[model samples]
Target chain A: MITPITETDLLLFYYQEADEVTTSIIREHLPENTDWQYFLNELATISSESSSLMCSPSNTTLSIILEESRSQLEHTL
Target chain B: MNAPIIADGVLIQRYMQGNQAAFETLLNRHRNRIFTSIYLLVNDRYLAEDIFQETFIKIINNIQAGKYNHEDKFLPWAMRIARNLSIDTIRSRKRMPVVVDSEGRDVFDCLGISVQSREDEQINQDEISALKHWIRELPEEQREVLILRNYAELSFKEIAVLTNTNINTCIGRMHYAILNLRKKMQKNTVRVK
Candidate 1:
């Protein structure tokens, strides 16, 4: 019987975090063709959007400043 | 603004030694990632921009004053500052009770993203939008884990370090996130048919 993959199991696979046995099980049980396609698509879509959200403009500026400040400080000290 | 791409550690060493150009290089390399991190937390582009600028200023001031430390962990440390500030801004709002509700709403509403990827054309726009929207509704813990693990391509150990969480908890959160997303997608697919 081709058991449906659980979210937990799928997550481990998607992240390449699962052990070989579990990974093999997931690969074997994965939905075929369009089913897997849409599944992968959905995961990518959400993850990308959330990543875009999490990294803020302020964070970028801070990175810039940190880089510059540290460099400048290194030179001075 | 314009500097060579030196390693972060090297840049930190240079900064500590008073190399201004080295500091700028580090900032340029990481600005976008850092900005996005802050933007996610606050969900306000304008406020995020302000905070982003402020974070740099604070860092620069600290460095000049010889107060900056944690050489290797600088980026994460700065991120910690940005996160704290963004959270503080949310708390200080007049409608503080409603902030969480509204932040989630705003993020969810924007789930319909127009991806500019080459393969995007192959995907149905509505379906893509729906999928993205559903992911947005996931719990913050799950969402963060998903982003770190997938989007940022951070390993569980790396994510654990970044979020100050354990590997098991990180994996668990990611599991729940995927599970919720899968359930939502299944429901949506059924509704469409």
Candidate 2:
């Protein structure tokens, strides 16, 4: 009997966290299943867009951190 | 030929040996993702900056004290620290009374709508601000999983371990978070048309 492919399984597969057998099953199953295929595409789009929204700390914060690191190095030396 | 990228482990070893440049390189490499993860959780840029600084200070102390054993897993380790600090600050803030401006409006209310500095930049910033608002609306658990997965870039297994939950629960939360965000975006698009 074939184990049912679940949304959770699709998520694992999308993130490349599935084991080899599950990965193979997802690979074979996705192309033949339109709903699953659409779901995968949605995951890809959402993941890509969300991950692209990168934010950086202010330069003042960066300077403080670097100074901290420098002081630590001096203490170690 | 391009220079081969130095690994995080090598950088850590060099930094431990008093190489400040190596540590800077390491910090710059993962800075944005780490900052974004903290900011998303806290929903305030200034507060996020404070937590980010605190996170790195602790990281430097830990490394110098020879307590940084995670080696190649620097981003996730740093992210875990940042996440913890953000959570603590948030909890404390919740206990305090809300701060409002002279106009009797919540000071934080204006923060969600980012200022558009240029005409060309407005649309992108608007979209990002909308997405941020939607993410903030999500349940805390789902939002945490999404941030750890996408912003922290932790694998499901790593997230499971960091969050102290089973892998299946993490994945399920992630699935729901994505679906909910997608639904929000689609609804927004339809409304805009």
Q: Estimate each model's TM-score.
A: 0.59, 0.86
Give the per-residue lDDT of model 1 (tens digit) for B123-142. Answer: 34323445444555778788
Taken over the whole model, the C-alpha lDDT of each candidate is: 0.62, 0.84
RMSD of 2: 4.4
When only the first chain is scored, the TM-scores of the models are: 0.50, 0.90
lDDT of 2 by residue, A1-77 (tens): 66888888788888888888888988887778998898888888777777656778999999999999999999998
lDDT of 1 by residue, A1-77 (tens): 65556655566666677778878876665655466656666666556545543332444545565556656555556
DockQ of each: 0.32, 0.70
Tell me the tens digit of each residue's lDDT in model 2 across B43-133: 7777888999999999999999999985448877888899889989989977876668899876655565322223224335435556667
Per-residue lDDT value at B182 in model 1: 64
Model 2 pairs whose backbones collide: none
